[model samples]
Target chain A: MDLAPLALSLQVAVLATLVAAIAGVGLATLLATARFPGRDLVDVLATAPMVLPPTVLGYYLLVALGRHAALGRAFEAVFGTPIVFTRVGAVVAASVGALPLVVKSSRAALEGVDATLVQAARTLGAAPARAFVTVQLPLAARGIVASLMLAFARSLGDFGITLMVAGDIPGETQTASLALYDAIQEHREAAALEMALTLTAVAIAILYGVGKLTARSARGA
Target chain B: MAPDGDRPSLHVRARVVASHAFALDVAFDAPPGVTVLFGPSGSGKSTTLAAIAGLTRPAAGRIALGDEAWFDADARIDVAVHRRGVAYVFQSLALFPHMTAAENVAYGVSRALTPEARGERVRALLGRLRVAHLSTRRPATLSGGEAQRVALARALATEPRVVLLDEPLNALDRSLRRELAGELREALGQLGVPVVFVTHQSEEARALGERLVVLEAGRVTHVGTVRDVDDAP
Candidate 1:
C-alpha cells in the first residue's frame, strides 16, 4: 500500500513536462526563425539529449545537480535548496530525458507556419512580438499540442535519469519507473506488472488523444 | 508645365537582381495618378512594384516620394517597409486567416488609434468597401471580390503617401474582375497619393491606368496612354 512512489512519479513527471515544454518552445522559436552565428551548433546541442541514452543524460545530470557541482553548490548557497536526491532533482532529470521530443515537434510546428502570414501582420502595423502572438503561434498551435503530448508522455516514463540523479529514495525521489524497477528486483512480481501496465496504458491514451487532435475534427474547431 | 498644385508624386529608379540568373533593371515615375506597369510574365513589372514598396532592395539607385527620399543607396539610407510612407497590397491578398474581416481592417489603424477610434475606423473602412456586413466573416468565408476589397481597405486605412497594387484584379473571374476593377480604380483615384499598380493583361492596363508603362523582357518598352500601346504591337 506504499503510494509514495506513485505520487512522487506524478509530481516529477508534471514538473519535468512543464520545464521541458517551456525550454523547448523557446528553443523551437530560435530553430524556426532566428538567424545567428553558430545556429547549427545550438541546434545540435539542444537536440543532443534526444540522441543520448537516458543513462548518459542521467550521468551528466548526476554530476551537474550533485553537491560538489558548480550549479548544485551555487543553488545550495543562493537558494538553500540542493537538487540531488530531491523531487525537484527528479523533475530536472525527467525534463532532460524528454527535451528532444518537445524541441523537435515545436520546431516542426513553427516551420510549418506560413511566412507570408507573418509579412501580412507586419503590413497591418504589428510589431514582431504582436505578429508572433496573434498569427504565427495560433497557426502553429497544432504542432505545439503535439510537442506537449510527446514531452508529457516521455516524462511519465523517465527512469534512467531519475535513477542516476535522484538515487531512488522512495518517498523523496523514487518515480514510478524506478519503483517498478525496484519492485521487479525485490521479486514483487504482481506489483511490478501492475505498474508496468499502468504506465503503458497512460502512454497509449496520450498518443491516441494526439492522433484525434491531428484529425480533421481539431482543424474545424 | 503640369498644373502647379499639392499632389503626391513618387520618383523611383531601381535595379533588381533576379533570384535566378538575370537582373531586372527598372526605373519609372508615378506622378499622383494610377500609373499602370503592364508587361508579360517575368518581365520585371512586379520587381518594380516590390522595389517601390520597399520589399526588394535595388542594386544601386534612389526612390523618392513627393520630394522625400525612400531609398538612396548613394546616401546609404533605405527606409524599412512599415515606415516607407507607402502601403502595398500584394497579389495573393495575404490576409490573416485567423482574423475576421473587420479585425483585418482594424489591424492597420489599431497601432495609431485608441480602441474606440480603431473600431470606428474599421467599421467605416468596411462600410466604404461595402463589406461592412461581412465584418465578422473569416477570410476563408469571403468571396474573392470581398477579400480583395478587404485587403484594399486595410492598405488604405493608414492613408499611406503612396499605394502600390500588384495584379489586383488577376485573382477573380472575368465578370468579377471587371466589377472589382472599377472599385479598385475608384479606390486608387480617390486617394491623393501616388499609385503604381501592376498588371499583365493589356485590357486591364488600358481600362484602369491613367498612365501605362509597358515592359518587354526586363526593360521598359513604352510609357504613355492606351493609344500608344494600341499603336504598338
Candidate 2:
C-alpha cells in the first residue's frame, strides 16, 4: 500500500489532461469553424476515440511506438530512453482515451458561441487569432473547462490502455487503478477499497463541475 | 469637379449570391455622412454591409474607398476583414460577455501606442457615446440603450475609415430607440466618416440618413438624398 502509485497516478492524469486539452481544444476549434474539403473526415478521426476500445487504442500506440518501430528507435536514440513501459507511455495512453471527450464537448461549446460576436471582433480590426483569443475562447470557456475536467477524470480512471502500453511497473507506471487491481489480487482488500473510494471521489467532483458548466451554458443560451 | 473634391468616397458595386434564399446586387456611392441602407428583413441590407466590411465575399464587381480597392473580383484583390479598418455595430450588439464595457472598447484600439493611450481612446469613445458610466459593467448588466452605446464606442475606438451599423438601436424600446437615434446621429455626424447604417423602419431611415439606398429583395430599388427619395415620383 505505498503512496508512490497514488502520486504517479495524479501526475499522469494531470499531464494527460494538459496534453489532451491543448490538442483537443485546437482540433475542436478547427472542427467548429473551418470549412475545407474532408473536414468531416478530420472531425471523425478526432472523435473516433470516443467509440474505439481503449485496448485497441493501446494496441495501435504499441505498434507505432514499440521498441522495434522506426519512431520508437528515433525517440530512444534522441532521448536515451524507451517510451514503452514508462510512466510517459501511461500518460500517452490516458490522453488518447480522454481526447475525444475534450474535442466533442469543446466543439459543441465553440459552436454554441454566437457567430456575430466573432464577426464583430473581426470587423473591429482584430485578426483571426486575436478574435478567437479575445472573443470565441472566452465565450466557450465554460464548456472547455467542463471538457478538461471530464478528460482528467477519464485519464485518472484509465485502466485497459495503460495496462496494455505502460504495463504495471511498480512506482513508475503502476497508477492507482493498476495498484488497486494488484491489491485485490494479493488479497489486500483494505488497500483496494481505499483506492476505489479515492477514484470515486475524483469522479464525483469532476461530474459536479461538468454539471455546473452545462447548467451555466444552458442559462447562457 | 464633384463636391467635396478631395474627400474619399465609398463606391460599392457588388453582386453577391449570399445563400440559396438571398442574392444581393447593389451599387452605391457614399460620401462622409450617414448613408442608410434602408430595407425590410431579408432584403440584404446586412449582407451588403458585410460585403463592404470584408465579412462576405462578392460574386463579382468591386468595392473601393477613394483609390484603394477593398475588393475587386476581376483584379483578384480582396482585403482581409481586420485589415480593412472598418468597424461594425451589430444589431445583436455582440459585446464581449466576459469583459467590461471599457475592455470591449479597448479591444478595438490595438494600434494604440501604449496602455495609457488605449485607455484614453476607450475613455474618449465611451464619453462620446455617453456610456462612460457603464464602462466597468459587463454587457449583460447594461440596459439595451447602454449596451448599444457601448457597442458604438467599441466600433469608434478602431478609428475606422467607415462604420457600419446594422439596426444599431433596434433592440431598445420605442422611446429608448428614439432618444438614442438622435444622439447616435449627432455622434456619427461629428466623426466625419462614412457611416452605413441599416434600418427597416422608414422613419428611422428618414431621421438618421443623409443619403438613402433603398433595397427590395436584394436589389437597390432607389438611391438618392433622403429628401430626394422622399420626393421621388
lDDT by residue for model 1 over A1-69, one digit each (tens)? 466777777777788889998898999998888899999998898899888887898888878878999
> Which candidate number has the best TM-score?
2
Q: Note the Cα lDDT for every prediction shown.
A: 0.82, 0.89
What candidate 2 gets wrong by more than 4 Å, as runs, is B228-233
Looking at model 2, the pairs that clash are none
Error of 2 at A43 (Å): 1.6
Give the TM-score of chain B in candidate 1: 0.94
Give the Å shift of residue A136 in candidate 1: 1.4
Provide all candidates' interface root-mean-square deviations. Answer: 1.8, 0.7
Candidate 2 lDDT by residue in tens digits, B12-61: 99999987877899999888889988877899988999999999999998
lDDT of 1: 0.82
